[model samples]
Target: MKKYALNLIFVFMTTAAILLNAYSCFAKDIAFQSSVDKNRVSLGDDIILSLTFTGTQSIPAPDFTNVEGFHAKYIGPSTMVSIINGSMSASITHKYVLIPLKAGKFQVGPVTFKYGSDTYASNILTVEVVEGPVSDNRPIRTAGVPPLKFEDKIFVVMEPQRTQAYLNETIPLKIKLYVNKLPVRDIQLPQFAHDGFSTEALDRPRQYEEIRQGILYDVLEFDTVIFGTRPGISNLGPAELDCVLLEKQRRTGGIFGDDDPFDDFFGKYTAYPLHLKSNQVSMTILPLPEEGKPQNFSGAVGSFDFNLEADPKYVKAGDPVTVKMIVRGDGNLNTVTTPNIGSQDNFKVYDPQFKQEGNTKTFEQVVIPKIETVTEIPAVSFNFFDPAKKQYVTITKGPIPIKVEKSTEREGLKIVEADAISRPLVKKETLGRDIIYIKELPGNLRKKDAYLYKNKLFLLLQSILLLCFIIIVTLNKRRERLKTDIRYARRIRAPKEARNGLKESKKYLSQGKIQNFYDTIFGTLQKYLGDKFHLPSAGITANIIDEVLKNKNIDERVLDELRSIFNECDVARYAPTEVSVEKMQNTFLKLERIIDYLERQKL
Candidate 1:
């Protein structure tokens, strides 16, 4: 107990010293800077303007009551603190959403903040607003949303690059989630109706600010490529997303004033599940034109460049020569097959190996000349429909010159003979030694298990054998049951699965993908619980803390920690900046503790 107390005191002092060092670095310099997430935005799009103050988190918010050419709304401030290798840095960023109202170039202010005795100023930023829609800027305003303020605080929008496209043509799709200065968390990926189109998993969503209807909003955009399988006018996507919306009850103040930059960090908000959906879009997918269609067109719809390469123009009979075919450009390469080649009768052709890297598809084929008379490799032809040209394109290559020489070597077997060496032998006495003589007197004889002590020893040996048999039988039964009972097997393997998930989380954290890292952590917890208790993972929720674990012999402290972890995960899903690295590490430790506890308990 004394040693444990001393260890705890040492940890406390160490943590305090580290934090003191980290924040002391923050006391040295105060840098005030301004930057915009985008230099240009569409008339209805939102621009994110950030005023960052380094070396301090006590700065007051900038007043933007009247900003020209754009409607400004203050979103919350984000604070970041870090200490690596005893090198400390800290900053607090005050971000605002600015919506452009007209088309023109305008210079925004060198925003000034008056905090206590110090007056801080930021750099001026120039922005340009454009008419119609924005192509260069990644942010876009929802096309059909009404200009007036609506009841919904959050919503989603879907946009397809083209309304009419050829079958198998790649379609770039973008889906955006817009939050109008609202506290939201636990945002899930959007699901949409896609009956005739095939799509890949959505790319990682990117966050930015946008303004719709004089209100500034935070936007998350998800992008993916889709291909149309059937040709016809099809309605795609009334897209939907599930998120937890937070409603602020009131401001919870800190040591600083009411407009404290740390309010968001310590603010309390209640969360409620919200669902959002977008409008449906009608798209016409046309089949390739039949007039100029090639006989070999295999549903490849895009402009492509094809190349055929053959190695070893000169080779001996029965020697293999390689043929490499590469098809590269825009479009769906998964639908493209290997191009056709001639001279199959003259050569022995093996199965071709294929690989795809981005837009390029490759085929490596080996062909051996059966006879020496074969002079050239056959010509290769590839057919694809060029949507831009509105015609079928056939790329023809090869018919190169080659030389085949007759094999000069002959096959035969030669006999090998072994040489023996002769040696002189010694006398027969040296090869064989003399025999042994028997002892005359015999030792005392004893019968087993005759006396009291001997009987006890024999019984002990039998008891040991019986215990070993029982252990072996128990282990064998467990092994057979594991093969048949999936629930029991999962329960046994829960700890290992949780450890693997934590490993993946650490890797993502190192890569600076905080959202993915937290996602793995949350998923790890859910999967761990499901596997440990034999519950379906999809149905696991925070309510289960009482419903599922109330009677399980879990300690009150562990249950409280589990509840805290679930709450933090809910908040960290969308608001990752509010969650610091230290907090995440603590969360990891807590998760390990919970898993360890559950690992020792049997359900």
Candidate 2:
């Protein structure tokens, strides 16, 4: 009986020791920590802000009122329990999706939370809100559909052709939209506010596809010219682009909830407004040199060719003559002026008429010789600073020679004769009759009753002729399409080829010949890309395809589909794996979709 009592005592002590150890573990110091998925993020991007409580499982939600510059929402709480070395510990993490409102550096938390008898404040986290989304490199995983990633999908970038330039020099700026798999619409043109530079109006947006970091993206490029007005550090911009994205919507609270298997198959899409912005770009504008400056420089800053010419080299003293001076080259032609022709006292010079055609400017001046003694028009010189040569160049043309003759038509003609020493004079007499003048008008004006165009019958005939002309032109274009245009013929036949290829692929798929099916699909794609881009089949590589279609402005979704089909084909052909019928069917459907899309495209 004593031994039994001792065993009971030992059992009670063991139980008490276990309970105390558990209690000590629970009573340990509560550790509060806060973190973010990324330290820097764009204004429209989402940052996962988390507050974790360790050493306890009964944690109340953290109060995140201290988070600044962002709108935070409590997503939910996740609890994790683990047993390490026979000790049980737990951690509760509260996640908040933080959407930044403005761009700047901000702080999140020092969030305070309560668990049992202890109060804990999380560590502070610093985040930077930039102008665009942070780049995410993780591969996307999807069950049925191709994986789509936010970072690879759609974004905007601002780039300059050159970062350093001289004052008043032209700089090419390109703002582009990069899209991978997103359906975008209602795209408003990008805009930016530049303080120290003058920008030209953006030209039409150009569409193309580019491969960046092994991912192909459809790029919409908008080009503009900017010139720095003053010397110093000049800013380009924080460009902003606005568009709408058609994204899949998550369905909730119905027979078909998120967990429903049919959700991925029959998903509904909603239009979400997306605003993208690019970071500001800086440029250094160096001041033009002050040395070797010309006195007659007219602020011209590019290469130019100068010439001078005069028409009607021989002219009466009082008659008008035209002298033209032309300067042509690539530069700011608007700022160019005619060179000064010194000393106008020998002639009467009218105000010069200036006309600019493209990169050439002509100055036409009307000059009348005031005296017969004047021999030539004075030489004209043009001086300008050539930035390329880094020197002042003075271009001088010839002093055009002119023969000035006395005007005989100013007054009646006069005849004079002179004899020296002794002279014999003979007198002659002649009789002349006065010429008779006509009394009638030179030409008869025969009047008609009505104009041919004013007649109703004539107008009806003309309309009929115009209708016939339109019909004939239309028929001629159709005939030309059938006979002369090879590209048109190819385009017309492309759909038929695609259908035949699809039929062959379907046959192979039914027979369970995976290699043959993928090879056929691959060949079809190569042919399609080649046909659409007018490229050779042998040269149809992924990079070559991207290059060929870069200027075609194909849609991002179509490009993504093409890339996925290619990748699937490559894997099925080279890798030794069991290709499922469902995957082959998906690939076939994707191919059909791509073919249909390309057929509808204007390329």
How many angstroms is residue 192 displaced in model 1 relative to the true structure, after the best TM-score fit? 1.8
**Residues 9-56 of candidate 1: C-alpha lDDT, one tens digit per residue:** 565556556644654443356788777766767787788888877665
TM-scores, all candidates, are 0.50, 0.44
Number of colliding residue pairs in model 2: 3
lDDT of 1: 0.76
lDDT of each: 0.76, 0.73
User: Which candidate's TM-score is highest?
Assistant: 1
Which candidate comes out best when scored by lDDT?
A: 1
